[model samples]
Structure formats: C-alpha cells, structure tokens
Target chain A: MSCAKPLSWETLVDWWAADLDEAGTSSVEEHLLGCDVCSAVARRVAATAEALRSMVPPVVRPEQLAEMFRRGVRILENPIAPGQTCDFHFPKNADLAVHVLGGLALAPGASVEVTLRSLASGTVLGHVEDAPFDAQRGAVYLACQRDYAQLDHDLVAEVRVGKDRPAARYTILHHW
Target chain B: MLSASDTVVPSRWYRLGSMMTEATDSALLAAIAAGGAGRREAERALCRRYAPRIRLYGLRHLRDEDRGRDLVQTVLLGVLEASREGRVREPEQLVRFVLGTCRNAVLRLRELEGRAQPATDEVLVAAAGGEAPRDPVNAAVLLRCLGSLGDRARRVLELSFHEELESEEVATRLALSRGNVRVIRHRALAALRACLDAPARGAA
Candidate 1:
C-alpha cells in the first residue's frame, strides 16, 4: 500500500472518495500530504465532489440547534403555565434562562427553589434557593450556569414548590 | 433554481463557533487523543470542520437525506470515541482518516439495508489525474466550459451528476446507449478540466 510512484488517477479518486482500505488510504494520504502534484489532484477531486453534491437537493435539513437558539429567544414570548414544565435544550456554557411558564403557586411565604441536576449521574450541577420570583408575572427564574462539559449528557431542571407541592421538571436537551 | 455553478456547501456552516480555527488537524487530533477539558472542544471543532463534506458524501451514495444525516453523526461520533481510546493515529493525515471512516459508514449502511451489490465509489474516477487541473477551477471559467458543451452532452452530465441518476436510468431518459452516455460525460468533463486549467482569457 506504500505508494512509491505517483498513484494512478483512479487510485487518487478512490483515495479522495475513501474507497481504499485503511492501509491503501493511509499510503495515498501520506503521499498527498507531501506530494504537490498528488495534493493538487486531491483538491480537484474534492472540487468535483463538491460540484456533484450541489446538484443534489439537501436531504438533511439545516441544524435544529439554531432553531433551538431561537426558541430560547421565544421562550419569553409565551408564559409558562402555572404548572407547565419548561424544557430547555442547549449546549454547555450557553447563557440560558430557565423559563417557568405560568409561574409557580407558592405557599404563604415560601420561596421558589430551582436546581439543575445531571440526569445521568444525579449530580447537582447548579442550585439557587429562594430564587427571585415575579408574583405579578407568576414566574420564577434561574440562570443556567452548568459547564458545557457537564452538559455532554442529558440534564434536568427541577423547581421545588415549598415542601409539599410537586416539582416541575424541565429536561435539558443539548445537541453539541 | 440551477444557474450553472455546481458547488453545494452546507448552509450556515460558518457558524460552528470553533475556538481552534487556527489549529492544525494534527494539533486538534492531538488534543482529542490527549483526553482533557480541551478534548471536547477539539472534537467539536473537528466535527464542525468535516461534517458537511461527510454528509455530502453520504447523500451521494445513500441517496437519502436522512441516511446521509445518519452517516455524518455516525462517522463523527465514531472518530471522537475512537480518538478517545487512542484508536485514531497519524493526525496529520486527517482528511484520509475522515474519508476512511466515511467509507466504512457507507459500507455499514449498505449492509444494514441489505443491498445485494456493492456500491461503486468511482463516479468521479474519470476526472482524476493529468497535470493537476487548477486547484479550484474559477467558477466563471467552469460555467463557461460547461456552457460550451453540446446540448446532449451537457444534459447527460446534468442527469448523471446533478440528478444523480444511474447510468441505465440516464440512458433510458436521454434515449442514448449506456456507453454513449458515459462517453459524452467523460468527454464533457475533459473539456471542463481543460478549460479550468487554461489561463484566464485576458491573461498575459
């Protein structure tokens, strides 16, 4: 598989398209990395592949991650119901706000408690006690400060309503 | 709709938010293989850099957009996982590594689908080699070259490459023999390559 001499056009094309086995591909790639002539051919083959790809309509839609981003923006537009669980999915290190729709119904003077936990390991990634709640807007808020590394897996945001009410859970779905 | 130039880059590709834009593939792979906080960032950067091309390769072979999407995720995830385990080597030959993984992904897909025959990966074989054509043939020059081709030849290329139809289907649709279809395509591509390699019209 060591391409001593320049590889044939067919072999280069195969290399470009990854048609060769590991050893053959490695040989061709090693040569292309150092050989100007072969590298130039590899570039051209890539260009042709790019051209052919243009002819085909996109089978896969654009990343939904962008849409999720916009959703973060629109989350404020619609108020979460009193008991509605707001689901937020985003990558780590994102400056995201947990939107609890319709706000929570707190006891006489009980404050809202928001906690971000890893669903996989049951680790508490972030916590906020007696979090600032807008009673007029019936909403509670917490800043999502978990490390992106912590977000490599699934996560959940739990809101505790005092000591007796059911907690509203928001599943964090991140695509990165 | 289809105005001449046939290059299709994935949309919004520049928004990958990579911090290692200046890092070489070797460096990125090294970081990935080293295993640390930087590994995740490097893996993300590498995936962003190559996912579009890998997806395009899948689309061409699998002929289904969803399957193509699957190929992209599968291959990239495999690379990240493999690199973590010290399975990937020779980071300098990064392109080949990605391509090799892509081929394996396609073959696996083919097997899963129970395709009776092996998929041919040489559709562009005829365009290979020869005094390495201009690294990236000028778009205007390429369009002019494609425009200069005879109608039937152009149509043949359109049907074959653009439409991605099989040779038999292209022949049936164009009312030409399969051999005739291939000849026209080969000749047309040659002409395009020559035009691309030639100096711009006003060059000294």
Candidate 2:
C-alpha cells in the first residue's frame, strides 16, 4: 500500500497483467507476496487478464498462411489458359479449397464445372459451381475438402464443358 | 497467355528479405502506404513475424487449433487489407490493431458458437505464468474483485496488461489526467485485495 512514488496496488496489478519484464514483474510479485493489499490487487489483475485472453480466439500458423498467400499469387499470375489443361493432385491429407475468379471475357454464357470423382469407387464428392469464362482474366478457384482424417483414396478433378476438351488429372497422395 | 513473359517470377520476392532486414518499422509503414509491390512485400514480412503470435493468441482464446488458425489467417488478411486501404497510420500501432481485431473476431465466433461467457481472464492468467496458484477458491475470489472495478478502471487495467500499453499512452487515449489514472488504478487494485481477503469471498 505504501511506496516511494505514491504507487498503489493497481500499479502492481497493471504490471502483473501486462506481462512486464522480469525486473518489474518480479518486484510486483514480491509486493504481492508480502503485502496483503497488493496480493489482493494482484488477484484481481490476474483475473481480469484471464478474462480478456479467453474472449479472444486462437489463430493459425504463419508458415501455412504464407503458403496460402503464395498459392493465391501463383493463381493470379498463371491461370489455366483457354487451350491448356493442368491437373493437380490433392493429397489424401489435404483438403483443398479453390476459388475461381471470373474474367472479363467470359461474361455472357461460357460456363465451367469442376467435378471431383473417386478413381477407385467412382464415388462423386461434389461439383464446384463455375461461372462463364472471360478472355481477359478468367479463373477457376477450386478447393477440395478431402476427408484425409478418415479414408485414404485417390480423387480426380474432371473439368467438363462443351467443345473445350482440355482435361487434366492429379493423384491424391494420402499422408494421414 | 502462357508465354515466358507471363511465367517470369517477379524480382520483388528476392528483394523482399533485404528490404525487410534493412527497413525500419517506419520505412515499412511508408512502403505499405505507397501500395503496389512494396506494400505486398511489407505485408508478407509483417505476416511472417506477427502471424504466429496472433495464432497462438487465438488458440488460447478459441481452444480449437483449426479455428485458431482460421482466426489468425483472417486477422492477418484483414490487417493487410486495412494497410492497403490506408487505414493504418503508425507502424507501432499494428499490435494494438491486430489485438483489437482479434478481440472482435473472437466475440463474433463466440456468438456463432453460442458460448456466452468469455474466458479471457483465465487465458490471461495462464498466459502470464506457466502455473496459476493451486487454490481455485482464491482464484474465483480474485476474479470477483476484478468484476467490482468500474469499466474505465477495468479497461485501463486490461489495456495496460493485456495490450502492454504504457501508462502515459493509456492516460492520453483515455483522456484522463495521469494522476487520476494512477489513483483510479490504485484504488481498483486495493478494492480487489479487500475482496480477496474477505472470508468466503471466493464462494461469493
């Protein structure tokens, strides 16, 4: 309760809450252990800190996120050209989510659908809704949610449309 | 469309590391403010450093790894977007901005999850030290003490501890005189101690 700088228990509380450096924090801890008033203050401060932290949710790793950004940039730079078909294999452990950004030219009536079919059992996961293709900067954003946590199976994405038959297939390598 | 020119990777990625290493925080802020390639590079670097922390913070709050990861990604993306839009003014304010955004995101997630009570206090205490005191009764009493403080005092305390803001900044932002801030902060602490000391306070 009594300090040189007219400091109060709140100051100690604040110090404890803020995760201050060792020196300041240690001093605050010392005070809390010795002074009943400060100890009480520390308890409240600690509680408040806990409450605030709980209110916030957890977030993902930076490396994984950086990879996602890199993928986005890659898609923007080199999309599937009109006549070229590229096949990508989703690993059994990977749940891929693709986003297709429609280009300017595919405005009127050009449509594209990406179907994911299991090669072994011919089981269909689902079809991704695609917009009309544009000449300027059309893109198909594709994301596959593979149940890697469950079964290990190779899934192929079949690109189907009228007249343009540039088909590509990828083998899913299941890790888990 | 698939020519070599289109395939050529931008030289910006190679330059990014050096720029990040050499640039001051202010310089990075300036580059971000300028927008274009420089902004992208700056954002990438920022994401690299702070994203992990954000994820860890999120994990502590959400208690779900996948959800936490999503929140981290969302927070970084939001920060990048804000930077692109010229909403962020100072580089030093980045932590505050990220933390505030994370707080809001968690609140929304809680609403979606239908969990009313937020465990921020418990999270903070655990984060502060590896081991909390073994006495649950005392811990509960302490929490009650914190609840007794007024909103402003609580805010100041939370900001000071959780966000690690300096007292001077807290006073300035809260528009309170430094002396008054100090006094209120002190009183709040004292009141908490009194509450903790009272018999059966934890039960209450």
Candidate 3:
C-alpha cells in the first residue's frame, strides 16, 4: 500500500539528499509539488542540508559534476545533422568500438568515412576510410586497437555517409 | 527535453568542440546570445564550469542535495534565458551576472519559503547596512565539530550522504538494528546542529 501519511521532515530531508530509491523519490516529488505544508518544511530542511553539504564540499567531485553537466547539456543540445542515434555502451574484453550512427535510409554496405578528431584542436586522431554500414543498426563501427589509456580527450567523429551527403559529426565525450 | 535514448546523435558537438578552446567569458556570452547550437554549446560549457559552485550555493542555502541540483538547473536556465532574450547588458561581465543571478535565486527561494528577510547566514555581505550577524555556522567550525563526533556517527553520515545508501542498507552493513540506526542518525544530526549553532569556542 502507498504511504498516506505526510512524510516526516527526516524522510523529506532523506529524499532531498537522494537517500531514497527511485520509486520513493518519485512519490516524494509528486507529493511535494502538491503539499504546501511539506514544501515549506522542505525549504527549511533544504537550508540545513545545504549547510551540512557545504561543510563537506568534497562529497561531489569536480569531474563528477562536469560529467553531470555534460549529460544535462546533451539533453539541451540537439544533434544538428540528420542520422540515426545510438547510445555508447563499452563492453569489457573488447576493442574500443566507436559507433557512428547514420540515417536509416543508408543501405547495408553503404560506404562511409569515419574520422575521429580532438574536440579542442580539431586534429585528426584516427580515421576509417571505408567502414560499411550495418543497415540493421543504421550505424558504422570504428574499432580502435590502441591502448585505452591513450584515449582520454574529448573527441568528435565526423562521418561522411557518401560523396554528396553532408558529414555528420558525433561527440565522443571522455568520461573518467 | 530530448532524452539521450531518443536522440543519440550529436546536435551541437562541433560547437562544443570549438567552444572548448579559446572561448573567453565574453565570447561564450556572445555565443549564448547568438542562440541555437552556439547557445546550447555555450550553455554546456558554462554548466560544466559553474554547476559545482552553484550546487555548493544550493547546499548552503537550500540545505538539500537534490535541491542543490535543482538550483543548478534553475540558475543556469535563468541566466541563459536572460542572455538569450537580450536582457544582459554587459556581456563581458559574465561572472558578475552569474553572481547576481545566484543572489536573486537565493532571495527568491527565501520569498517562496515565506521569509520576509534573508536567513542569518545568507545576509548579503556586500549590502550597505548595520552590522550583519556572523553566520551561525562556518565550514571550519562545522568540520571541527564533525570530527568530534564518534566514529559510528561519522560513518552513518558518510554512508547516508556520500554513499547514498538507505538506512536499512546502512544498518545491514553496520550490523545495527534498523531502529538503532534511526536513533544514531537522529542523535548525530542533533549533535552536529547544536555544535554548529553553538557560540564560537572562545568568544568572550
């Protein structure tokens, strides 16, 4: 059964601190949006939480914060070029695989050039001259055998689908 | 509000790349003012640079971790919206603009909470007025008080906040009864509050 009672201040603080499960958090958020009394309590609790957090500044690292920002920005910044989109999932015990997504219209065996470049300097880091499309996935894979330790900088993959098609650039953010 | 799962393609990666290098505060501001992909990239770069600081502000004022994150989103979006709408007069003074936004955000939060005045610690240091009360708590004093707590108390706080573990999980790990865990957490926070709000150690 769902909790009918107003959540205690401690529970509210815990929710605010993200010390709750996803379901608990969602329920609390939904309740807070509607309950004025709880909202007021949360504001005060938030002040206390802030004080405690400020006292412990190192709780969240700079890189973690940057990564969160990067993720949030990804939501705001739309991909300008037209192509299929796919998420990057690194598999253990496999070569570094960069999936360059292309439009669904791209047929199987469609030739493409995948050029990886440094985001900061625009210097070419690697290139695959003739990677064919996996039409099922509508993407091209650029497998790199270099030591993973050597790939730490933010990069962009410029994928030219065909001779006349516009090159679609994909951001490859390096997460630590 | 594009979910990463929904749109995996790069919308503004090139701009993100170029903006990473040689973009001054003014140049970033200009990019934000230009709108579209330029604006999005600038927003990303700015968030990456300032979100931590803003989160700290949220923690100090809002006193909640989730609220601190919300504060980052609120402040950044507000600043970007203001910039995009051509409201920022001094594009070069981006730092000042951000500080002002933060101040306004804190002040607005107070208003929302029905507080007619700023919280004691939130007294505007730059305001021209009578003596502002010393903040009830300072980081150094709080840290010192935190260290004074027993190891168990410290661990509970760490596990609860840093590890983001539930009380039940924390109890399981610590081998304490769930009820005892709650008691310890309550007593620990109370002790900390009392210590932090206490008068300076040697004030005559």
Per-residue accuracy of model 2 over A128-172 as CA lDDT, tens digit each? 334223334444443333323233245555555434755444344
TM-score of each: 0.37, 0.30, 0.31
| Alpha-carbon RMSD to native, per candidate | 24.3, 25.2, 24.8
Give candidate 2 regions above 4 Å deviation.
A1-176, B1-13, B114-204
Instruction: Give the per-residue lDDT of model 2 (tens digit) for B1-204.
Output: 576655555554566767774565556667777887676567656665554455545544565555665566666666767876778766666666766777788787777874333333332223223322212333234434555667687666655544557677878988997667666665665565566557364344
Return whichever of 1 and 3 wins on DockQ.
1
Question: How should the candidates be ordered by TM-score, best one leading?
Answer: 1, 3, 2
A-chain TM-score of every model: 0.40, 0.33, 0.42
Task: Compose the digit string of candidate 3's lDDT tens values, residues B88-186.
Answer: 788766666766676687777767763223222211111112211123355445555665688688677656654557788999988998767766775
Best by DockQ: 2
Residue pairs with colliding backbones in model 3 are A46-B62, A46-B63, A47-B62, A49-B63, A50-B59, A50-B63, A78-B11, A79-B10, A79-B11, A80-B11
Lowest lDDT sum, 10 consecutive residues, model 2 chain B, at B125-134
Number of clashes recorded per candidate: 7, 43, 10
Tens digit per residue, CA lDDT, model 3, A28-142: 6545533445555565555444455433221222243345456552212112234333344344544223333445356756767766677789876555555445566555544
Candidate 3, residue B21: lDDT: 40
Worst 10 residues of 1 chain B by lDDT: B121-130
Q: In candidate 2, how many Å is residue B4 off?
A: 17
